[model samples]
Target: MTDTYDVVVNGASVAGCAAAVLYARRGAKVALLERRSDINAHKVLCTHYIQPCGYPVLAELGLIGELEEAGAVRNSAQYWTRWGWIRPEDRVGPGVLPHGYNVRREVLDPMLRRLAASTKGVDLLLGHTVNELLTDDGRVVGVAGTAGGERFEVRATLVVGADGKDSAIAKLAGTPSETSPNNRFSYFAHFRGLPRPEGHSAKAYYLEPDNAYVMPNDDDITVISVLPSMERLGEFKADLEGAYRRFVKALPDAPDIDAAERVTKITGTVNYPLVVRESTGPGYALVGDAALTSDPLAAVGCAWAMQSAHWLADTTAPAVLGHGDLGAALNNYRKRRAENLKAHAHLIADYATARPFNHIERFTFSAAARDSRMAEHFHVFGSRLMSVPDFLSPWAVARCSMVNGRALLRPRAQPVHSGERVLTGQGAR
Candidate 1:
């Protein structure tokens, strides 16, 4: 069998579906292929925290309303460090910084697939696996593979690889990729009745070489994740359940895990290497994890996927519609990917080393915990809304320094400890 489209996207998860829906909505015929026959299957190892940068794209796709209607929790973040808590001034209403959503991928993935399948010009082909790129004179023009135990081919003006970090399309297309090792491993699961530190707020603990998150999700469910350095693997391997519970239960301002019921089996990602692939070539492009899979600790995967899809569609759909230059459109898409993500990837990769916080991080974190304005800035930057240069301006640094100076002159106060050292497993402080 054979099919033709203006764009053919491989992998119908977040990125592929977003691209297909957006492209078809823009008047281009698209074919979205997924290897998994089960449309409802979700990524088991994801935390599914969508950042603010993804809100506009989600809204544009008309997914935000549906997500909210499905009980997605709108949230901001609060961080706990040794200095104290960094709480940004709570802002009410829309258009605020550090705002995002927490909807489980079980709901989100199927929703995206259905949206793409129902879009006017998309053919959602589940159970289709691409085995090789169909090339025309040195440029990828389509794909050949198997579907339902039969050979098939899909031809298109553009080919997209959204198959994730282990993208078969990317490999078949020979896309150059670079990888950085992660020094930590992650484990997380959903629980019911876990107490929240505040209403609909996500919490993070920066415990030097280890970190943990309490992300509130829809339907009164909460996700608790711990990312401890690789050296602690033996502890987790010996007894993952007990160590996981004890670790989270010991954090400062920790949630009441004892009061909660474990609703899901634990999921862990122990070898998630930071991967960056060349975003575009000839007649092909990449989005989501196929393009870049940074440290999951930043929770940028889902957001970056949708936003990159938006970038790809916004830049290249005109060309697909015969209204612009294809080569130039491809160039613009490449530029967008780099300009938006390169710096963020650098920071995420650096932190993936699981090293202790650097001097500047300590200085800024201390000041942010002391001052609301600094906290807001820190949150904004951490949310990836502000560039590193802008966040570390001389004015910002001077103000943070002032905040720290004022704190040093104040009388010493009793230290805040949860009951024990969670990371080092030391006795009560």
Candidate 2:
């Protein structure tokens, strides 16, 4: 069978579905193909935390209402560093989404799939896998693949590779790529009745070379994840659950896991290669993990996936709609993507090496823990709401220096009485 459309998108996950919905809403006919046979299938190996920067995209797609209806939790971010807890004051700059959402992929994925399938001008093709690109004189025209064991062809003006980190479309197109090794491994599980984090916010423990997270999500479920450097892999391997539980129980203001019932088996990953690829080609483009895969520690995968889809559509739609030159538009999209993510990606890659905080990182993080203003700047930058240059502005640097210097020079508190004992442990009794 043969079909035609304005755009044919491969891999109907977060990026693919967003691309389909956005493109179709713009009046482009789109065929969204997914190899998965089950429409309700969800990604299991994900933290599923969307940063605040991505909330606007969800609102633009009109999914925020449904997401909230499905019990998505709005969450701010707080960090526990050696110096102290760095919790930003809830401050929203003009036009900035102040908080992020915690929606399990089980709910988020199927919700988006259903949305894309039902949208006008979008043909959601389940059980269809693109096996080959249909090219005309070195330019991609569409794709050829099988749908439910039957050969199918889709001829379109543009093609998108939203597949994933291991994107078949990217491999077939031979996108230039580079990968960096992750020096850490992670384990996570969901629990019911876990005590709410303070202010119901997301808590991250920057335990030097190791890290942990407590993310409260929909349906009163909370996700606790531990990411330890590869040096501790042996300890984790000896007893995964034991080590995982011990790590979680040791966090500052740790959740009441002993009282909470674990509802899911432990899920762990040993290696996650950070991938960066050229996002555009002659008649093809990539978004989401297909274009760039950062360390999971950054927790920006889901957000960046949707944002990249937004970028792709906003920058290239006019050209795809025949109002402008396509090549120039694709180049424009590439530039926009780099301008937004290149520095951030570099920072994430460097941190993924499992190194302890450098002098500047320690100075800034400690200062943030002490000063709410600096904490807000740290939070805003960490949330991916601002650029690296903006976060490290001269004014901000000067302020951080002053804050850290004050914290360092402050006199140590003297005991009220000689018999007074200072408690030195994490969490409450």
Candidate 3:
């Protein structure tokens, strides 16, 4: 059987949904395909934190009100470094936009999928898996798929590959993806009744060499994640619950996660490498994880996906509606994404190797932990309010250096067992 649309998107996750919805809203008929039987499904192994940069897109899509109504919490970020806790600076002035949202993918993903399905020009096909790209000459024209043991084809003027980190469409389209050595594994779960830190914000506690993040979502539920290097995965996986508890307990301002009721089983992913791929080619484009995926420590995935969708829609709408060339539009999309995120990617890629922070990072974080003004700047940086270079201005670096230098000078006390190490023995943390 054959069907037709103006654009066919071969994934129904947030990125794909965003593309479909935006295209549909622009008056193009869109077909959104997903392999999952449940259109409301979400990626279970995600942190689900939306950065501030994604707010404009959500507001533009008219989803802000709905998301908040659905119990999404507005929050800032706190960094728990070994030096001390770096909370947002209150003196930076009031009336600033809140940093980001700590949401559960279980809730946000379904909401987004439903919104896309409800758009006027969208045809959402769930439980259908794309088997190959249907090309005319050398240009991608549509997709072939299977649903209910039957073959089907969807022909369109353009095809979008938003099938995520392991995108088959991207591979079929001849787009090469490069994998980096992320050798990091993460264990996460939801808990209730754990005392949230005194402030209403998400916290990233840097246990250097390892890290833990406590993100407060809607209701009393919080998402706590531990990211340990691959070499340490065995120690963590051997006794997941115990290791998790120990990690939480070691936090500077430790939370009572152990005392709290376990609301979900400990879930983990092993050796998840970060992947980035070229996002555009003739008659085709990619969005979200299909284009790029980095470590989740930054919590920018959802926001980047939503924002990229909006960008892709704007760039492609003109061409799809007869105002520009589809190939040129896709090329433009690639340029835009690269210009916006390349530096960010470079920084993350470097950090993932667990390299010791340069003098600048150490200074900035330490200063932020000492001064609210600096902390606010750090928060803005964390929330994507500023770019990396801009956030690391000469003045900012100097201030951080001065403050950190003083702290370094005042530090005293030598450890009696400086080289002592804790060995993992098939037990929890």
Candidate 4:
């Protein structure tokens, strides 16, 4: 038998590092490949908002405290719905994943990378670009790539593609993925010296076709961005800074981007449509954005990246190490990935269209904003911790109905008919 590792992971970002570290901890010999020169290299064009759903992985990896010490800001979520702003006081639910985090990629990327490099039995191979997959009998057995300008090969029982949205591994492995059109484009820049907010809360503005999001990161800096309908892409392309300013200023409660200095120039390339790929095959699997990437309008990408990696490791590690059935392990990973994310992805894709919220949506948003219970459910739903059906349960629907129905009952002036005029009680009698 040719010498083989338990697993070989391509890419060394959040998803790749998490899977590599966890699998190594489970006593598996793992190889982690990175195209970059160093594992600590930072990724640009990322919002870095890891929602509540991703908290457990941070905790499980024991990095949450270190991140907090590194000045990671824990934040709750708020949205300026069309009717009004929906502010949830804090993240709900008790046991785990109680609060989300806002940490810049500059801080997070290195931390995850270092942890993986330090883990026992994991080889962190840097500066390697996977040129092709090695297959036998129509099943992937390993990968052949280049490192230091020379070809290299790593054989493994399982291959993991965590190379992000534009996955080279998926392309080489002949995995099928669907790309959905994105009706919006995003623009973002970081600002320094903004007046300190009293509490940590990430804010999102819903302005029909145009939307804005703002969050507090470390170093007293804030990240703010706008998602304008794709129809305005050409307009933005013509004058990027001016278009960005216009959208920021249009926020119902606009931030003072004018007063604060921009730390980085407005950053982004052309927006790509959402992509979803199947998670498993005969000998290879995908994790994170490589498997499923959707609109970032709701800030769910980072969280999902952490989660999918953790889930992949949890299911596949035992089988890869000869403790379980490989087929069943792969299937479990696939189902869990789909069951947890399918509905959330649907909602994100729908919102990516940049369409105005309809009446029912408006009512629900308004109601969720007004009541604590509704706000709690909204918090869970927004964090991708709850599905649409789970969030809009019959009881929840009834509550929204009651709240909106009562809102309609507030007194309003009745139009006076023809010649009739208002009269005092005494005169009428």
- lDDT, ranked from best to worst: 1, 2, 4, 3
| Candidate 4: stretches off by over 4 Å | 1-3, 90-97, 412-429
Angstrom error at residue 14, model 4:
0.4
TM-score (C-alpha, index-matched) for candidate 2: 0.95
Question: Best candidate per TM-score, number?
Answer: 2
Better of 2 and 3 by TM-score: 2
lDDT of 2 by residue, 123-240 (tens): 9989998899989999999999997778999998889999999998899989999999999999999999977755578888999899988999999999999999999999999999
Q: Per-residue lDDT for 358-417 in model 3, tens only? A: 776777888998877788888877776678888889878877887777877974553343
Please give the CA lDDT of all the candidate structures.
Answer: 0.90, 0.90, 0.82, 0.85
Query: Which lDDT tens digits does candidate 4 get at residues 73-135?
Result: 887767887668776663443323357789999999999988988999888888989989989
TM-score sort, best first? 2, 1, 4, 3
Q: Between the candidate structures 3 and 4, which one is better when assessed by lDDT? A: 4
Deviation in angstroms for 167 in model 1? 0.7
Measure candidate 4: CA RMSD: 4.8
TM-scores for all predictions: 0.94, 0.95, 0.92, 0.93
Model 2 misplaced regions, further than 4 Å: 90-97, 414-429
